[model samples]
Target: MSHHRSPPSPPPPEPPESPSSVYCTPSPQSKATTPSPTARFFLSRHQSFIKPSPLTKHILPRQQSSNTLPPEFPYEHDTAKTSVGLYLRKHRRTNPAIWCSAIICLIFSILFIFIVVAILIIFLVVKPKTPVLDTSHATLNVIYFDSPGYFNGDFTFIANFSNPNKKLNVRFEHAVMQLYFEDGLIATQSIQPFSQRRKETGVVVIRFVSSLVSMSSNHARELQKQVMSNKVFYSVRGTFKVRASLGAIHFSYWLHGQCELQMSSPPSGSLMARTCKTKR
Candidate 1:
């Protein structure tokens, strides 16, 4: 009833194409011209592995150069530091005691020079003077000769000690007198110690008596001749140790004196003529 007559017979199946058809066969020209994706990928990966990185190329030369060179000293960097190092090395070789002793000796030398200069200046400014001494008078009291070689005589003498300095005082430490008959020493005497002010003179008195002295034959004859001639010759020598003081400054000296006497007296207590000389 539906009348649908069987659907129109299904369409007939299409026929298989032949191997030589354009749609069924691959083109050899296209296959030979273009590379495969797998091959292209492999080549790109090989190139990436072989090439060096930019960072590595820059750093490698610096490392190699640093490793090859010798190590450098640190002190060569600054001139000031090098000089300081050298200075320290020099001082390290010297002993500290040596430096200290050198400084002390230099100081003492300066001080000694200063003291000497000061003393010289003081001497120039002071204008100091030396003292003087002299014999003032001499007298022959008596003269007598008994027997062949026995002689007796008496004499008196006076000495004058004077201080010439205007600002100094003098002290006589010792005074000695010797009576000489030609080259023979007959008698010696000492005087008392005394002090004299500046520009002052002190007097010393002495008396001597000769004992019965034995004389040589020649001396006795000479003396007799002198007595007959009414003249006698004698010598007096003296030594004095004196110290001069002015404030804190003090000086000492030895004084010597020689005096000659010629007396025209016989058994009298008076002098005829005398002469004196002194040295300091």
Candidate 2:
């Protein structure tokens, strides 16, 4: 009713083209394409799977070998620290005592050696001696007498010797008494002492006698005549030598003396009294 004319009579239906003609047909140009939202999401997910992230690229893989060292290296560091501390503590404890003992021993050794050397030098270099001529006074006395049968006069001699040393130690080796007649030597005799001591006097005694006889023959008569005509006098001379030692000192001394003799005749004898004088 609405004047709707039937839609223009339906156009004639198009026929299908031949296969050779379809190959020659030109395609239409497409509009600028925009990916759908769902398609775009799918494409982004795929790209993420193909490419790696920045953080993952920068990181390096862990080494598989056990030879690699750890970052801290705790074992070597602890050993070095422990050794240093022990050395310091030990040095602090013993150093002072060791040095002090060494110094004390050195000083004592030096002192001992010095004392020994000094004593040796003193004994080797010094020499010692004692006093000589210790005897101060001496005296001699001689007496002469004539006997009936003896041709020469009998004489007795005595000697007194004194030591002045306060602590005297004297030794007498030998002593001799020589008697002279006028200017000629007559006789000699040895004197012996009884005792010796310090600050004391020593006494010596000697006796001498002569034996001679005159015969009636010519030679013996001539000898008697010559002897009777000669003048006779008496004198005494003697030497005394002594050696003494005390401690480490040694002493030696020599003494000489001379004296005259007095001769007296007995009541029944013909010889007269006379005094003999010493020559020197």
> Pick by lDDT: which candidate is best?
1
Q: Which ten residues in a row have the lowest lDDT in candidate 1?
A: 67-76
- Those runs of model 1 whose alpha carbons end farther than 4 Å from true positions after fitting are 1-130, 145-150
- For model 1, residues 28-144, the per-residue Cα lDDT tens digits are 997898779998899899988997788878867774555332336444546556777998888446889999999999999999998787557546875545555556567776667
As a TM-score, model 2 comes out at 0.35
- Candidate 2 lDDT by residue in tens digits, 88-153: 788445688888999999999999898677545534543212222212222222222233322344
Q: How high a TM-score does candidate 1 get?
A: 0.56
lDDT of each: 0.74, 0.51
Q: TM-scores of the models, in the given order?
A: 0.56, 0.35
